[model samples]
Target chain A: MLEITDIVTSYGKIEALKGVSLSVAPGKITCLLGPNGAGKTTTMMTVAGLLKPRRGNIAFEERNITGRDPGHIVQSGIALVPENRLVFPDMTVHDNLRTGAYSRSDDEIEDDIARMFERFPRLHERQEQHAGTLSGGEQQMLAVARALMARPKLLLMDEPSLGLAPLIVEEIFRIIRDLNAEGTSIFLVEQNVHQALKVAHYFYLLEQGRVTFGGSPGDLEEDEVIQRAYLGSAEQT
Target chain B: MEFVDYLQAVTDGVMQGAYYALIGIGFTLIFGVMNKINLAYAAAAFGGAYASLGVAALIGTGDDFGLPPLIMFLVSAIAAGLFAWIVYTICFRFTPDHYELATLMATVGAFFLIEEIAVHSTAGEPMDFPEVLQGIVDDPMIEFSDAFAIRGDLLTIFLLALIAMGLLLMLLYRTKLGLATRAVAQQRTAAQLCGISVDRTNATTFIIAGVLGGLAGAMIGAAVGVLSPLLFVPLTVKGLIVTVIGGLGSIPGAIVAGLLVGGLENVFLALRGITERDMYVMLLLFLFLAFRPQGLFGKKAVRD
Candidate 1:
């Protein structure tokens, strides 16, 4: 489980995350839905230790991970699939995945890599190919698979479906569901509320760097303003 | 008749290029990993070579009661690597990452700092380096038509440079540390997201490059038969020239470009005077910049 309380993050003169808070329960997909510039990615980055917060705390399964080094945060079993699926372009797919397990010193790394190949067959097919050459959908899959190589207790996926085709979006949602079912907790930041609601057990709507609503899909559907803002159809939701 | 002389000059030029390649590879690695050129690199090279000279001077390189001839190279390499790490931490570590110019300017200052230290320490005088290829540079090792023979010392430098290049290539492609370094080079943020410490990788990269630089300095000292603070600025300029011609971050490009520049410089020196020689070299650099901005091996506008 992950818990964030009243965190504020900034870049130079501008504060991106201002007094924000959220929680992700264990073994569940917790989706954070927000519009552009709503501090969704910033929240994930702050929790992942990429961005330092000016105030507040982040607890990952009772350990206060706030202000920890990114490498230490990763070692503590949290892996982030960053926005744009920033896979190392010049690196081979296999090398990219290997880098994903950089913090692990266990003997099972090769085994895990083999397991990853099996889990993501497309990755296996192009394991030796450079990741930059991959299609956007393939790169997204590779990014997710790369993060899974870390064997994290919590997976932080930032905009996994952005710029992906519709069919690929479905595949991404399916993968998220499968990952959650396999007991890996996912804290996903997404703009696609409809597809997100289908896989997520709980969803939090973030607006202007603050959580406006937290509820189940059924509850979210009944909220008129939330449906209009995200789903774009108060009549259907 | 004159063609034979030109050919000999080019051959000799290629030998000189070997030294440039050694130092240029180090510069290329630093540029690749850190994305910031360390202007102090050649200074580090000079510093390392001088430190080795100090050791060699103290212990002597003779057979009895002295260190082995090759031990100085290793000593210089390790010392240079550590020295470079210290410089990296002090000069560039905490600088804002986005402002690459700031780091570049800081390194410019570091270059002066390192050069001044060398100058003050040695009283700005050229010191003779212990000859690596003993009793051979004046004599031809492999004679060809009397005019195109490979000088023993130059041949040795070329062979040593080739070996260094081979080892560097192996370390980069066939090792885990190299993997992390390449990852960091390609995408720093993505590398971090994967739990790879970009800072540590960048540091390791600098150390590796510094080791290479030290070897280059030692080789240059051995070849030129002298060590002087005056060699510092010129070597740094040559390195920058090599780095640019070889493509900004491309190692293979750097090596090839180094040899090209070396060959061209010698040809020009033989045909035109020394003044005209450098002008030709500068012109070649300009051509690469104006026409082929990507340089010899830069095939793509890859990095953002």
Candidate 2:
């Protein structure tokens, strides 16, 4: 479980996340939905320790993790599939997965890599190929598999389905559901509201560096702002 | 010009290329990790070499109770690594990451700062460097005909460089640190996201390159039989030339390009005079920039 309380993060002169607050319960697929430049990625980055907050704090399972180094945060059992699936392009798929397990010196690394290959068969077929040469869908799958290699208690994914084809997006969602079923808590940031609403047990809408709304999908349908801003587009699609 | 003379020129050039390869490897390694050039690298290396000379002068390399030849290398390497750490702290650690120019300027400042330090300490005077294989007819030469021969001292330095290069490759390809380094080089954000301490990795990379620079400094000193601050600038320029022609971040590229540049420099020296020799090498670099900017063995533009 993770709790973010009124955290403010900024670039040089501009505030990207201003007093934003949210929570992700354990064993659930919690989704953050917002339009472009709504600070969705900023929230993910701040929680992942890529960005430092100027105000407030973040607690992971009651442990303060605010402003820690990314290494410490990852070691605390949180893994992030960053926006754009930033897999090391020059590295082979196998090495990429190996790097995912960089913090762990356990004997089961190869075993976990094998398990990742089993789950993503396409990855097994191209394990030795450079990740940059893989297709966009394949790269996304590799990114997910790489994050999973960390064996984190909590998984943070930012825009996993961005720029993905419809069929591939569906497959990604299926994997998200399967991962949640396996007891890995997921805090996902998504723009595809209709698909996200289907899988997310609880959701929050982020707009302009603030959390505008938070509720179950059922409550989403009843909210007027959600009806016009998000579901309106989902229904049209 | 005789065919044997040309062959001799190339052979000597290749031997000298070993030192260039060592220096260029240091340059490429630093570039690979931080994606920024350290202009102070050669100065750090010369500083190490000069420190070793001071050690040699104090302890003596001539008698039964004297310092072993191996200590000289160790002193140079450790000293260079220390200087590199200082360079990292001053030039790289505090500078903002996104603005690469700041780091670049910082390193340029470091170059002059370090060079000035070395100059003040040594008083801009050249000192004799201890030679390997000290006693031999013609200082020991391997004859391939009367016209072509390899100087024993240079051959020893070349072989030592070869061994150093072999160990470096093993460290890079067969270790966890190397894996983290490569990951950081490929994607800094992704590497951090994977829980790698990018700062530690970058710092370690600087030290590793520094060690290589020290070895190169020792080699250059041994081959020339002298150590001087004046050699720093020319060596720095040559090292950069090697890095670019080898590609920015490729180790194998550095080796191959080092040899190529070395061989070409000598062949030009043999064809023209010393002044025109560098002109050809510069022209070669310009041609590479105009045509294959990536250099031999360099990867095409990296994807985000």
Best by TM-score: 2
Worst 10-residue lDDT window for candidate 2 chain A reads A228-237
In candidate 2, stretches whose alpha carbon ends up further than 4 angstroms from where it belongs are A222-237, B61-66, B135-139
Which stretches of model 1 miss by more than 4 angstroms?
A222-237, B61-69, B135-140
Give one digit per residue, the lDDT tens place, for model 1 in A1-237.
899999988888788887898899999999988767878999998988899999999999999999887888988999999999989898899988888888888888889889989988999999999999999999999999888888999999999999999999999999999989999999998877778878888888777677777887788553553454454433323
List, residue by residue over B1-304, the lDDT tens digit for candidate 2: 9999999989888888988998899999999988899999988998888888777777764543144445677788899999999999999999998899999999899988888887888787887776766543454788777888988877887888889889988887788888899999999999999999989999999999998899889878877878888898899999999999999999999999888898889999999989899889889989988899999989877655
Error of 2 at A95 (Å): 0.9
lDDT of each: 0.85, 0.88
CAPRI-wise, candidate 1 is medium
lDDT per residue for candidate 1 within B1-304, as digits (tens), equals 3888989999989988987887788888988888788998989988998898888778865533144435667777888898789778877789888898888988889899989998998899897776665642455377878777777777777887888889888988888788888988898887887777888888888889888888888878877888999999888988889889999889998899889888989999998978888788888888889998988887567744
Clashes of each: 0, 0
For candidate 1, the lDDT comes to: 0.85
